[model samples]
Target: MRPPLAAVLGIDVGLLQSGMGGVAGAELACAVSNAGAAGCAGGYKLVGAPLSAMLDRLGTGTDRPVGINLIPEVVGAEELDHQLTQVLDETPPHVYVSLFGMPDDKVFDRVADAGRHLVVQVGTVEDGVRAAGLGAVVVAQGIEAGGHLLGTARRDELVAALRAELPDACIAASGGIGSPEEAARAVAAGADGVLLGTAFVVAHESRAHERFKALVTAAGESDTVITDVYEIGWPGRRHRVLATAVTADPDQPKKFIGKTVVEGKPYLVPRFSAAVPTEATTGRIEEMALYCGLSCSAIPAETSAADVVAGFAGVLPGSPAVTN
Candidate 1:
């Protein structure tokens, strides 16, 4: 068996919440990290003064070590540079999970210079091995994962494959492992930890809309669809979302469907804007993107982030043979 993620991640628990864009903020991050799990801020497509301000707010809210996730390839060079500078300038997170692409030596060195762990999300064994060679931890993301998917393999298969390929590499499983039981199964299957996203989307501390939360709560495994329907800012990427009304309409224009003010500035909202809906989203509720995983079946109608973390800690893997 491998060492628990708590030892490797410097966090108290073996679970890590996904850095869900717009959904996870300081409030949710602080709550989860304080509960012993690693909390992460979604830093995708975010930059400039706004990014700095968000980090400042997160820093002020929690003294615990929190992480920030970035997809360098998805975000342009200018945006990536500005976002990195902003985070490094003020409060650099305790960990940096780079997804979609690998960061160059300079970026890796910068993260190490800030005394943070570099985590790379990989879908295949080749990528996992590559990331391990770069002295970075690997997150084995399966196809069942919500939002932006990484790999086409099943979660257990990916975790087992990654562990077999890199026995010494620290490996975590993300995707469909949602419940405490599933989390335990991943650990038993050779994963050092589990990264949960959909389960926590319904958490009280999450910044998602009430309607979105309700839809997730009522959704089942068959209710989700993975497509590039909402590819306004980030294109050619497949994201798993609920089969809402907008997804049914193929000819929906890529215009601002709604308008909301951010930091006292009004911004036009596009399809899948990565901007979480609020009371101000004056548009068709079911027409917007609703990202979720098949694991939504295990989420309760209402639960606290602390409670969710604690619940996972109490669960024990059923049996090695069963989990395997």
Candidate 2:
């Protein structure tokens, strides 16, 4: 028989990567997957050529199962439909994840019929229950998570509530998970898997800017802030970013339209969109959304994705050793 949902989803060690936008690209995704952890590529802001290239790399680079996360609320209906069409038509990710909002009926049915795994991230116990009912794995994201703040409950509380409420549902924990001990604690608290963002954000294979990674490495536990400063296409969404000068922008625009270059091509998008960050992008790095969780202190100065998976392996039940 196929293993339970956790194993089948490559979350056997109870570890997963958070698929941060512009950060969790192919190199990082492949590295995490090769380490036997589920790595999700952020697909919410990507479309057309850029989206296609990312999926192509993920598909060709790794033998392990991978996933792609999408935020339905920010993509808008027309763009969402268009992106979904491109994904299904060109190169669909191994798993399709919908965050902030549930997938529409057509997308849900399409994923189901295609035998692809679907995951829904919820902020509340009620939403978790709804995701379970829809046959999608429920990612119970706590406010401590980096990038986007999802649910209101603490990670442990959310896992316990979900386990108690939905006995058969497979629940994953996100937020404030940065070390093996943290991952173990989440599993012990009733989570089948743990989703880590900040830990891998500093991974050697990650595409995060050097300064971004350095800030995370040098940060302490008290360095994070959840603010709506970067709100543009998706307003009122509080994301956990490093407490930086840019977050202090009192006159931050509610909605901004601008042209930013990615990979040497001009792309028009909302300002502060996570995809705006690239190796070539310059100026105002501090002003950009510096996504991070509360666990920056737990990250070592230098580590690879494989080592990250290994760090948590020893704590997981029946998991293999972290090998080089």
Candidate 1 regions with alpha-carbon error over 4 angstroms: 92-101, 262-264, 271-280, 316-324
Q: How far off is residue 116 in model 2, in Å?
A: 0.6
- What is the number of residue pairs that collide in model 2? 1
* Poorly placed runs, candidate 2 (over 4 Å): 1-5, 10-12, 92-100, 252-260, 267-276, 321-324
lDDT of 2 by residue, 140-235 (tens): 888888877765688889889888998878788888888777877887787777778889888888877788788889987788887877765567
Global lDDT of each candidate: 0.75, 0.73
The local lDDT score (0 to 100) that residue 105 gets in candidate 2 is 54
Candidate 2 lDDT score at position 260: 49
TM-score of each: 0.90, 0.88
Note the residue pairs that clash in candidate 2: 123-151
Model 1: residue 44 alpha-carbon error in angstroms: 1.9
For residue 104, model 1's alpha carbon misses the true position, in angstroms, by 3.0
Q: 100, model 2: CA deviation in Å?
A: 5.2
- lDDT (Cα, tens digit) per residue for candidate 1, span 126-152: 778888777777888888888877667
